[model samples]
Target: EADIYQTPRYLVIGTGKKITLECSQTMGHDKMYWYQQDPGMELHLIHYSYGVNSTEKGDLSSESTVSRIRTEHFPLTLESARPSHTSQYLCASSEGGAGEKLFFGSGTQLSVL
Candidate 1:
């Protein structure tokens, strides 16, 4: 398993504010994903990429966007955050297989007030 880290661990901002959650992986992984979840709720995949320069929106529709400019970095950004955007954002990376283990970063808890 690779070590993944998310910066700021926590964030709070007013509505209409723009924010970015950072996620970085130590090990190079081709498959990466971002999931959003509220307290006690199921994780909803919001973004993912097969590799660099390849990004796809996941199952859940999101107001945020993600970019994979480097192999070790994936950052999620919200142009205009709202109260409805409050949630825990999780980042994970895998070796790209059906049953491969995923390396997850400490999530970023965002609060938009």
Candidate 2:
């Protein structure tokens, strides 16, 4: 089993509205990441953290930013969400490579109007 969490399994919001997608972990892992995906789509790394005090944006960004809100809460914040931001945001954490398999919880499928 994986030790990760997310809320609002699904959400529908109008354009220009702000929303925060919550993520948390209990495994005490130092590495955390956020991947965006859709049904039948690939998981693209959108954000990640190497440790508690470090944070960086990923290679991709339609419109998503995440803060190490806390060691356990790596919530994604969208200053202004649009329909294009409508998709799935997944939160994950790992210890290292090789044995580091991605553990995912049910993603938050967002629909912006």
Candidate 3:
């Protein structure tokens, strides 16, 4: 089984609500990332962390934020839900060396009405 885990496999909420997406890995990987994807569209990197206490914003402009306090946990939070924020969020972890494949979570699909 994959070490990474994401909660709330699916979410439906009204606009203006705050939500937090949880992600965790048991593989002890040093590199973790969060990706945003839309139906029939490419995945976009939204956030990443190289290690505990190290977090960085990715190429995509996202209203969401992430925090990495422990090596095995990385959670993303949206301050306020919006229709435009509806999409699939994937959490992945990888070993830092070259040629290491990323292990992704099942993903969380969010919908805002």
Per-residue lDDT tens digits of candidate 2, residues 4-68? 88998989999999999998888777778888898898888899888776788887765777777
Give the TM-scores of the predictions, in the order they appear: 0.95, 0.90, 0.95
Check candidate 1 and list the clashing pairs: none
Of 2 and 3, the candidate ranking higher by lDDT: 3
Worst 10 residues of 1 by lDDT: 95-104
Instruction: Provide the RMSD of all predictions against the true structure, rounded to 1 decimal.
Output: 1.4, 1.9, 1.4
lDDT of 3 by residue, 1-113 (tens): 54899998999999999999999999999999999999899989999999999999988999999999999999999999999999999999999732589999999999999
Model 2 ranges off by over 4 Å: 97-99
Report, for every candidate in turn, its global Cα lDDT versus the true structure. Answer: 0.91, 0.82, 0.94
TM-score of 3: 0.95
Q: CA shift at 112, candidate 3, in angstroms?
A: 0.9
The collision pairs in model 3 are none
Q: Which stretches of candidate 1 lie over 4 Å from their true place?
A: none
